[model samples]
Target: MTSADTWIAAAKARADKRAKEGKVNIGTYTGNVKADDVIFSEVVKPSGHKAYDDAVKTIRSVQQAGFVVPPSAAAAEFTKAWQDAGNRVLLGERKPADAMKQAQQQAQQAIDEATQ
Candidate 1:
């Protein structure tokens, strides 16, 4: 379970070594090829694992819906602050508005630091 490019690179490297060893067949995970959908695509409609296939569909749907955001350096800081604030609110230790205001300042600070 890696990206297609990574999987292809690793497979090629292993294939080269196996070819040098005079092996004609790459061993299947299961004893039968029909059971290994990742290797033999004809055995399965898409990815062998249902979870992976579902994830692909979900990602595609999200992309189509324009719910994606570009990666940012301030994201980590904002995530930490937001999670802390959320937890405090859940525990009745802070008001939602106050917690959010503090989290916003922290995220702004992170952005300022990155820009400097």
Candidate 2:
């Protein structure tokens, strides 16, 4: 539901407040929070004509070449990723645990390979 978006945003705000109150690891979507209840966006490969990929290339290159944006260019990078992903975006009901598990698995795989 669209209301979830507002709630999640509020939760984030509260978590930030809690952090200011010396609370760490207590995020709005941390416990019992469903991913489906949060904003969701998936990037799909764009068609040939539209979409700028230089930013993505740059991000990968930055990761590979050890680079960091100087804040001034951060917005541009975010914008590019959004645009290049064919502008296909959705927001709603994203459970925190599922996302975290998938991310952890991917990271674990990468780490396993790196050590091997």
Candidate 3:
């Protein structure tokens, strides 16, 4: 299934399970649903999962630091060119210098095209 479909299915499953349990307490600071059970707070106390907690901490830290950057078309083009060059080098198709020079040229061309 698609990403959105998978997400919806997972969410519906969670909701169904919670409803079956008869205690639904969904936490979300971004939501606007005013309710007695729904917690609208910045800190959604740890879930006890190390990996998930770490990811949440990192996301909250980045959000607090205002480090989130908007997507850039030029950066995407440059990254694709850079990855192609690295792949070519890895496959023994081109020398490192030649691959990098070509990558740079492609990225520069993308920038030029974007500006024009």
lDDT of the candidates, in the order given: 0.59, 0.41, 0.60
Q: Tell me, by TM-score, which candidate is best.
A: 1
**Deviation from native of the Cα of residue 73 in model 1, angstroms:** 1.4
- Estimate the lDDT of model 3: 0.60
Index of the highest-lDDT prediction: 3
Candidate 1 backbone overlaps, count: 0
Compose the digit string of candidate 3's lDDT tens values, residues 1-116.
Answer: 43443444454556567557864424232212232113323214455667756775565445434432236668788888889999999999999999999999999898888778
The total number of steric clashes, by the backbone 3 Å criterion, in model 2 comes to 12
Displacement of the residue 57 alpha carbon in candidate 3, Å: 18
Model 2, span 23-67: residue lDDT tens:
432223222234323411111122232223444334433443453
Candidate 3 pairs with clashing backbones: none
The TM-scores of all predictions, comma-separated, are 0.41, 0.23, 0.40
Deviation of model 3 at 41, angstroms: 30
Model 2, CA-based lDDT:
0.41
